[model samples]
Target chain A: MQTETDLVTGPAPHWHEGVSIIDAMQDVLLALIPITITGILIFGTGALLVIITCVTGAVLGEIVARRFKGEQTNLGDGTAVVTGLLLALTLPPTAWWAVVPLYTLGGFLSVAIFREAMGGLGRNRFNPALMGRVFLLFGRTTLVYLAPYLIDFNPAFTPWLEELEVVDVMAKATPLLRVVEGMELPSYSTLLAIYEGGSPAETSALAVILGIIYLIYRGRISWRIPITTVTGVFLLSLFLGQDPLFQVLSGGLLFGVGFMATDWVTRPVTDTGKIIYGLGIAVLVVFFRQFIAELWIGYGGVAFSILIMNGFVRYIDKLTARRVYGQKK
Target chain B: MAEKTFRGGIHLPYFKDLSSGKEIERVPVPEEIIIPLKQSIGAACEPTVKPGEKVEAGDIVGDSEEFVSAPLHTGLPGVVKAIEPRITGTGSKIKSVIIKVDKNFSAAKPDKARNAEEVSKEEIIKAVRKAGIVGMGGAAFPTPVKLTPPDDKKVDTVIINGCECEPFLTCDYRVMLEKPKELLQGSKFLMQTMEADKCFIAIEENKMKAVNNLRKHNTFSNIDVLALPSIYPQGSEKQLIQAILDREVPEGGLPFDVGVLVQNVGTTVAIYDAVIYDKPLTERVVTVTGPNINKPANLLTWIGSPVKNLLEKCGGIKNKPARVVMGGPMTGTALSELDAPIVKSSLGLVVMTVEDSSLDVDDFRPCVRCERCIKACPIGLYPNYLSMAMEENNVVEAEKWDAMSCIECGICSYVCMSKRPIVYLIKKAKEKIQENKSD
Candidate 1:
């Protein structure tokens, strides 16, 4: 007969659903495989190198931040890897080598500052990967200003830039940039097949849809955000007298809606809140793509729109809160 | 036909197969029986039997003048050894009557059975009160008190809750299957006593065998057998009412408020025994099964049998159980010791092994705003927000979020990816709020 000390006791529920943070994070990583492969197939070794560097930097940054906060490192959770891969997929392929340090800094700051500084994973208000991408986007002017001096100081850099063979293939204007520049648009089949001159993840809408399907099948995400986002973008673009198909297929819209905007921690929790947040991002994306793109070249409307909506998630959750059972509406 | 169901409950992996197939074997009377005087939810009963007094199996050991409380009866023919406070399955110390079982005692046959149709409504209620029967489905609320609602409230429908939706619990299902006639007769007595027009015997689709059995034995036109979806809290009173009659009991109210009354199948059977055989609440079928048990089976255990004896009847533990829960896994109380005796509400003894109860407090993560808890809550309250409020010790915020409305079904904690003990925190918050209110 065992004594009472041999028994373990806790709360009423002696069973669990067997889901863990590690499993969920691993599911996200698994879902990103198709899109990551498509990105590599379109942009070659440059995209692969960027993905590797960013993921490594994010993981290292997570360790450093945890150590600094006097907390045990949670490197096995895979959240840092997700942040890094997402940030890498949003960057232009050709610019990978030239801005390696800057993007690495972006990755580091994403985990260390945006995520860990706000008390880590689920507590962060903004999507850390988007915050990282937006950081690099804000520094675009500084890079462009230093481009001439750097070329003059190091002539080898010019030839090294030219050595990127995939650059010539994507030298043509991207579809969304064409919309901004009033250039002729490509056919819908061409866009869906292998669109170039955009971020690595933006290369194939087919790949992004495949990843979304996997996430949905794994029950890691719901259709409330992504479906509402796509519908909202399509109808709103048409309402604004724009080509809805071109708008939906171009830029980082599909990738953002699939990967970044559907982030569990940064988005609203309820179904109704997710729909409202999705539509809110759609409106801002249209406003930024059509109007704000002219003011700033290669404007990342999806990143900014998602971050802005992330701010209102608390309010959205509060407003659309479910009525208590048996309580009248 | 489409199976009836309510929204927001999880599909649990019902481990009923462990004991569902085993016939309920009668456990031999142990050397000692510790009967807690206060098994029901209301006021505690005072001990009526003195130490050294000889008692019969059907003798009343305790009684109370309170209208809400039920009397206590011993199931063993023995001498009262002592009267003291003893811990019960729920982890509360209550005044109890300890009896030493007689070595040479024979089971007494019940008196001639009375016809149910000839009994008056008042007579049925009197018999139920005399039987000291409570809601055997875990709440242990006095059945007679529930049968007697206010005059203004009209209870037209009676729901016989045979859902047994809790995982690893097959006692109720066994009762429904083996004693279908008694259950139907009990249902008739409940409907007659409550003046209800219709009675629905609700069983989850997973228990189609029991549903078919009950339907086959059922002869009354007014009694209908319903097959509901196998959701975790499908047997919960409010959800059961909503799924069957499409009536919503008002907030902070009860099934009686919505012209409905729900009685568990075990309680219904007890009502049958009470009304017909003049038997008091004594032995009940309890499922003693889990992954750690050597022999998982259902036992017809006496009311005051120690959990250790019940476990011994199941061939003892295969390994050191990580958790010994007193009821179903979803809403059961984890027992700290095996000394606590089974009471009126003890439904099952689930002995979880280390692998089954692997939830670690160290692995708890912050809420990722996943809304799984919100979606899984049958009551439709925001469990995540309520958990956050309680964590910060904000009682007002917790109250605003309807913390009191939480049924503590443990669904929020079970489905939480972060493994946060949301229901535990919510329970703490409810306690804090109640303290403030009394202040």
Candidate 2:
């Protein structure tokens, strides 16, 4: 009953809007609203600029990738925008202007090239934003160190990157490193200052908390990874006699745990796997911050831990699967 | 007390205003009806009536080829015109029998009203199977087959899915308001058939009017009316079962695995018709709404009616339709061809029109690994990796990640900020993988 032309069109006659995937993606963007709002409120305008820039970069990166591949552009999916916003949140507030293009390029490479080639979106194991941040940190560490000055570090002065103090930028260590190194705890008020005691992104523990709560509320991400990561860090810090509050609120620990490390794709799927994943990051973060004395590598620790766990997710899922009725494994 | 709402359900402005109060208006029958053979899940029925044969409403035009398939019945008294291939709601092209309605063909409306009396289990089952009733909750899976619990399993509870949880569709709500008695009767019949210990009707708290109306005059004491927390996919059989009975339909298994049978309210009403009047599944109440549909109202449309006919009935297209779906916006399939016929499982025919097409597809870009899809998935499957495995043509990896367990609810696709076609990718993976397995 089939015609010759049917072979070229493929099997089975069907009609679809060719818009199914796009609609699905839109729904995801809408769901991220609450957490994105929390991020904007916490980091102020610097974070907002990062969000806008990252989203724009992500879209542009996809378009460029599609162009390079000689394929039709699907810039309408908003996947790039999501990548941009997520990458922005993970960046240091005082990061150099050069870091924006570097990270955006990295995101395109990881998300558009590697991830897209592996299959775009949900198929990628490594989070694009995290990959972008990691790429920037590793590839141009010198430039990243200079990134905070490129953007307007002074929120009261101009709030735009072009209006910032150029060469007179002051260097500061994150709070987690200070606590691990046995420095006296800065007063809560001082700790909340603009990129002084910690990274601008994680300086405001209050904002991270709000974002985390919003994520949990929206069910955009699970509480298991973040809750377990935060809990593990807090409990492990208590064991090491480090201040739990500093560990919880320091560096990108909150942002990493609340946002990145808990990424559903790279992290293990099973509850047991999630717990292991969280605990692994906690241990690595502590080791990096304390023994290595490298708080600079703390965020990298989360990325590495996720990469390791992503490899072992299959076995972990097998071990954690519920026993099906009337089936012998 | 904690709110049982799940994470990641979108809250769009529900435009259920027009049809919420207006009684369902029966639209005029089309000149010709194109009835798809495989409307329900499982194998498509083989045609029994050949071309040039006269057929009447309730006459079986197609016979079931397998235990899973439902028989096809004529929706109108007409002359058998042609049996040709046509596209279905799922976008799959299947052989459909087209019947041209005879002029002056206002046949007698089958008597559907019934007395408040208990029906025997066997009679209910037989009637439901004969009526070709499927889950009108959009799946259109044969309802009787679902009710018949396996011999090995025991069903003690039947849950009525009144969640209508999908944001825009209000056909269930209109049904609840208009014919609570029929739904209640259908529930009773289902309870009796399943030999259930109890029955529960789960309605969202938002549908206060329907809840109140059902509660005030509800006759079935055995059927407890519980107001469930409003959540997307709460209308899904497994999710609804979890919320009401606290029973989990095991991953990679049917609801019978959990010793529960979930039925949509509309499907229940269809059962009432099947049992009371021997009426075959023909006409169904469809919600023709959304921004693009003008004068939005709940319609009693016949099976095989074209999308254009219904849109025209709803005062034509309000604006340039960005997308046309056969069900709710969340789980509904986008109509690539408006000529596709309305089938038995249709609950609402939605026409969404937004100024920005970006809202439809942001741009198929790279996934940022936000974990939004993972969090939003009620089944807890990792869509990101699964989509990857599918892309690589690695069925083993996809299967390992529990790809088969995916209910295909589109939640992952919906929640993905990257606007990635996670659902489509996964669907393609599932198809390719299944094809490989079969080979």
Candidate 3:
């Protein structure tokens, strides 16, 4: 019979046990549930289609990549599904259905080639969802020139507000555009409407709120990054005399804060680093909306700015490393 | 003063309450004790006691010529059963001497529990060196060499690191709270050996009760209690000095470079025991508690005891333990085998079951270049670039990125939004680059 004995020194742990990365990913997925529901309610079936297409595309891409590389597939972990869902949230609500293949390829490229193939989940420096979205953004821009030949028409050229049905107003006005254009504060009642914004993930502020709360409660994401990001945007907008409410509600702000900016793979690992990352994303978002107001340029600002920040992740970590005990900084 | 801590350290759920306040309990010698020849960081000792030999407690069983190594002692008076190479907690092979306990054998009670009578500083140093003591607070660096600073440098102060700053660790706290007299006596011993003018017992504010206990022990005017802000790695040499003395050990330099020597409260106690009891470093204080265990206590266990026995003693697993970690949450390695023997410097044996399920490993995507890692790094190193460089196998670039400086604390990976394992990249770079240099 084994006897219970107290530990005296030898190695650091007398016994061993720990939680796996798969469990952590599940918590993150649970957190996204609220935001996902909000996006679906506001954008109607289009939002749901985008989420389905992107997630399916990402997971399939992962399976194919792993099979090709002679590695075992792990779809049950739910990471690929979360990446797809996050990518869907960053798109325009009226985004063309063509996003399905483009985002799918992007997700696969990020997760499989850039992430797993390179080093597996925790090793990649770039955010897979953002990378997939960036690919779609780049792909869309290419389609603009080749769109007539490909589809013979462009839906984006149509005035989105005029095309929306009465119920669609809830999804017509994206939070970002409102903040950028310096629009008056929308009432909580208006914000609650499902189809108030035209942006893919921004229409349902209520859904995003639910999502963030879920993420926090589930421990998938830290409260620090999203909170700091929104706080930074709020503070910076105020310093420039931009309406704080408009900034908070505008253009993917909620969606970005709730989901995109909080991606555990791409953000900082230190608490202070997360705060800096949030502040940086906020500052860049405000800077682009305030100064450069170009149609294509501003749409990609968050992704672009975040990409730039990701490049300096190591530097940020060093700058913020806690002072070693018994030593000077 | 600015709060001191290491960057990227994990805030593991410290089940310290299980054993934090309890007196250290000595486990009876089991039917057999598996004593490994190599326990510390340096060379594995050559077995001095043969199989079938009857050895007394405190007798040296293994000795090494390596300067950075410590000798191993027999924890029980028994007949050696066999000598064989076996895997230890670190997953390395070392020669182990197995001794079958005599059912009638009882631990000889220590002669007297008394502080050291003021011996000459030289005599104390000789005793410490002879007893084969090392830093028991984790690093396992030989303690005598640390106490004997270079002749060129003058020492002014000695800081006793009572900051069991790592989460899930309370062995030092137990030493300070229950063995206060010995802890103080150890500090006094170090002060005399180093010829230091003052000694500061730096404890984190989170451990206020332990700090209070040490202060009330009435050791010496020079030995003062300092309550530091609670933070991870606060007990690190550089951070501790900064917290107490406002001094910095130059980067890529030793604590002696800063005119001070830092010792853990546990180490000081070990020193006191070695000199007072004439015992070599054999047994130590270990914390055995986790979510799955029925009981957690600070166990005074003999070195080289199989961890599986300890877990069985703690009522075994309540559920399938997620992973068996050999250290604190941040820096500990997950154990792959239960048969591995525990060695010196085992600060904690945490059975962490609940993980942040959201942070699970999925397919990694491209880095979006968010500087969250940069902002989060306490060491001021850029992880993103280091990772990029590492991905490209640009060891030269990784070096330029200061990849070597990363302590692999997992903070970068912990707070990452994209869930990138920035720590792994840095670790790979460090190991690969160091290998290249060695070759």
* Each prediction's whole-model lDDT (CA): 0.86, 0.69, 0.69
Better of 1 and 3 by TM-score: 1
Q: Which segments of model 3 are wrong by more than 4 Å? A: A1-329, B1-10, B30-34, B49-54, B78-83, B97-117, B166-169, B246-248, B293-295, B304-342, B347-401, B408-429
lDDT, candidate 2, A90-152, per-residue tens: 665443455556665766665566456654545565666777777755765555466545344
Candidate 1 displacement at residue B144 in angstroms: 1.0
For model 3, the local distance difference test gives 0.69
lDDT, candidate 2, at B40: 82
The candidate maximizing DockQ is 1
Task: Please provide TM-scores, in order, for all candidate models, with all chains considered together.
Answer: 0.96, 0.73, 0.69
lDDT of 1 by residue, A241-288 (tens): 988988888788988998999998888877799999999999999888
Q: Distance (Å) between predicted and true CA of A55, model 2?
A: 14
lDDT at B179 for candidate 3? 89
Tens-digit per-residue lDDT, B257-359, candidate 1: 9999999999999999999999999889999998888898889999999999988888888877468989988889888888899999999999998777755
Please give the C-alpha DockQ score of model 1.
0.67
Model 1 chain A: lowest-lDDT 10 consecutive positions: A148-157
Q: Write the per-residue lDDT of candidate 2 for residues B154-178, one digit (tens) a residue.
A: 8888889898987667889989999
lDDT of 2: 0.69
lDDT of 3 at A161: 31
